[model samples]
Target: MSYDKDDKRTHLELIQNVVTRMASNSFAIKGWTITLVAALMALSAASGTAKLFFFIAYVPLLAFWILDGYFLSLEKIYRKIYDYVAKDKITNEEYFSLNMTLYISRYNQIENNKYSGFKHVVDACITKTIFPFYIGLTVLVSVVFTLAL
Candidate 1:
């Protein structure tokens, strides 16, 4: 069969397999986002920065606010896609992956490598690691900035 057909078949299988895990991961990331926001607010309150209009002025210390949202948004979308795929609403066969090994097995048969997928469906998990790395950097910078003033 053609690569597209094989790809489709693989995805249908992948969705059947990974959807639950993806959704759970999304919920976890959302939980962390909420906790981070709460903690930041609490810190700013404790610092007496609340005396000023910028009660959460130390937010930058706790987060790169926009980046955190971006990470969370990505996670939300990722989960949403998994949900749709699992329900068969968005029946795009390209989203599934039964195995990279299977791909490698068929790689020699394909005319080209266009079938190589981004693995974005799993990108959320990687970002789960990456966001905190950036969060720490931003928080450190924000703390230095706060101290400088």
Candidate 2:
């Protein structure tokens, strides 16, 4: 696992690419999730069957919420990897041995010290863009559920 200088440089470049991709992926998941939720809201409104779909709506919302959090978590981890490589001049062996969970566990420890799991998840999702979208859907869901009832 000994890397020459050239190999170390190449590996560092690849790690930076991974970090960029992770950030892109996190945003993509957020976009797609919101789109799906919007489609559901439109269908429910058009069909005059809002209550029937409220539970269904919750499915994607909760699933995507967790997924988005997972992606954000991964993105944060890769950023840490990037920092590790840049700061320490990581070896090829160390680079290949990187594990996402190592950083994730550290994140959990820090977050749990301050907040409960539910609170942490909610706080994570409540970013400016994500929160507004979810709040709108929630209001719509409430309206539909109430009207359906």
Candidate 3:
């Protein structure tokens, strides 16, 4: 593939669009988590099914948390790839057929880049938005269940 300045910009824009979708997915996951939690809360309180609903609540919470992290990691890697192409660090062939694994395989080599799936999970655990929201919901579920018992 021949490298053109316009082509690089186009690729970068596409990468950014992917990143945006990843974020949107994360938001959707959060919404689902909240919806499930609320439904579980209602069932527990009204149906006297607190034990089962409370236990089940953890499933969606944990599942979505990990999924959200995975998407964030992907977004981060694509951002790195975008930067490389935009800066002309790699030729068109390398960029066009870029291995998705390139980001995770040689993560440390990229300056200021830490885009591993595991790292994203750790970061999500500590991030103000993700961490607090999930933790709070989990704690709320646990406390409410305990009090019901």
Candidate 4:
């Protein structure tokens, strides 16, 4: 775990990298949401009809958001694992596999931070709002919207 000569800059850099990655992900999803919302709104205005299908696209997107949040929580678990290795609770073998998986476990350029605290806000805000929104929207579109069609 702990490396010799671990400078503050390195930790800060890691945090910055994680933030950048997350910002990029958010940008992509939000960008799509805006585009979709615009299209739906425009269609509603033109046809004088509102369709819920516009929001349906966000369902899987929110699922992905929540899944990423789960991974961020795993980062905290990794800290505990790192501590175990540091304290001799786990040996070098355990650490080696973890180190190896770091690079292999990427999900479409999203690296496994294994220590970032991104999950804190995601759990609090995303679960309460975004997740339920996705679910409710999906159900609405699937049942009620389909009936409209």
Candidate with top lDDT is 3
Which residue runs of candidate 4 sit more than 4 Å off their true CA positions? 1-3, 7-12, 48-100, 103-126, 132-149
Q: Which ranges of candidate 2 are over 4 A from the true structure?
A: 89-92, 101-123, 126-136, 143-149
Model 2, position 20, has a per-residue lDDT of: 80
Give the Cα error of residue 94 in candidate 2, in Å: 1.1
Residues 18-98, model 2: lDDT tens digits: 778867886887788778877887888788677767778888877877777666655556776666666664544465545
The model with the greatest TM-score is 3
**Backbone N/Cα/C clashes per model:** 1, 0, 0, 1
Query: Which residue segments of model 3 deviate by more than 4 Å?
Result: 106-116
Which runs in model 1 stand beyond 4 Å of their true positions? 1-15, 48-98, 104-111, 114-149
lDDT of each: 0.47, 0.67, 0.75, 0.47
Model 4 lDDT tens row, 1-149: 54332533344345445545654665465456446544554564456354554454455556555654554444434454444444443333443344424432332134344433454546633555356654665464456445555
Whole-model lDDT for model 4 versus the true structure?
0.47
Error of 1 at 20 (Å): 1.8
Q: Write the per-residue lDDT of candidate 3 for residues 114-133, one digit (tens) a residue.
A: 55567666675566767788
> Would you estimate the TM-scores of all the predictions?
0.33, 0.68, 0.83, 0.38
